[model samples]
Target: MKRRDFILTAAAASGALALSPVAATAAPMVFTPGVVAKELAAGKTVFLDFKASWCSTCAAQERVIAALKAANPAYEQNISFVDVDWDDYGRHEFTKSLNIPRRSTLVVLKGDQELGRIVAQTGESEIKALMDTALNAATM
Candidate 1:
């Protein structure tokens, strides 16, 4: 194969890899609080949901939270969880702190590292899986 051809092929392969899923979207720091910051510093896992009053999705997400807790009492009990009020008085502070564009975000972090996130999805099972993965990763 010609050297020039090889170089062109390599460049195309690299570009495609960059466009792949894992490389395409790095996790966004949509929500992070002081308490959550502390937990992460201690290598603890935080599973939090950011929501506002007007978003119907937030209300439904709350139900998912309830069901998740009921199903995994042990995990629910151990995980450090909190809700950021993106609706009212706390809105500006949270949005500024996390550089969040909108509400209805779920963030999982261990200190400064984010494992995964669920965006524009309402599957209860999938959300729990992401939460559990973060919780499980923190322990390891």
Candidate 2:
């Protein structure tokens, strides 16, 4: 193959990869209490991610949430993710009020109603299903 042809092929491949699923990443979660309360009051699907920076399961769940949201962009509009940093904000009054048992816990709620809860779950399918429960509940 010609050098110019090789360069063109590589550029095209890189562009395709950029548009692929491998480039998909989860969106950032909300960390503000006032925003969370406002979203809930507005009847949005709320996801409380009780996480610590040092927790592996929390990291995995974060990835799973991102991938799911990437596949279903509607989740961005319908779901409001509130990340509760157990390492920094563990003793915060709102954290205490949520009654999170441990780090890496995911609590899904629609307004005031609890939809589903998962603790230290790393399975992508299971995590997506759990999130789907919240999505399904939100539509109803």
Candidate 3:
């Protein structure tokens, strides 16, 4: 292919990828001590994602969650999504308190009550159901 044609093709592909749904989805808030508690105290429902950067299971779960959120904007609007890096907070008191067993854990919390949880499962339907539970709790 001609250099100019290749360059233009590459630029077009990059722009398309940039505007993809996954790319447009908003990222969850990075976990910070007291942030979860603060959200709970304010009566907002929270969806906690415990993941590690290097874990394949975590990556799969993240993709499912992102897709679910992209499909349903209500999940993002009603639930306070927080991402807790397992490497940073795996042994932290907060994780221990929630009884999170491992990195690919997803938990939904509402006013000190855990509405639902998923561990290492990356099925789209399952993740969507979990997200639905969070949305229900949040709207309640």
Candidate number with greatest TM-score: 3
lDDT of each: 0.68, 0.80, 0.93
lDDT by residue (tens digit), candidate 1, 86-122: 7552456645666656677777777676777776567
Q: Which candidate model has the greater lDDT, 1 or 2? A: 2
What's the C-alpha lDDT at position 58 in model 2?
Answer: 89
Candidate 2 stretches with Cα past 4 Å from truth are 1-7, 22-26
RMSD in angstroms, all models? Answer: 16.2, 2.4, 2.0
Tens digits of per-residue lDDT for model 3, 107-132: 99999799999999999988889999
Clash totals for all candidate models: 1, 1, 0
lDDT of 1: 0.68
Q: Which ten residues in a row have the lowest lDDT in candidate 1?
A: 22-31
Alpha carbon RMSD to native, model 2: 2.4
Per-residue lDDT of 28 in model 1: 23
Q: What local lDDT does model 2 show for residue 102?
A: 87
Write down the TM-score of every candidate: 0.66, 0.80, 0.87
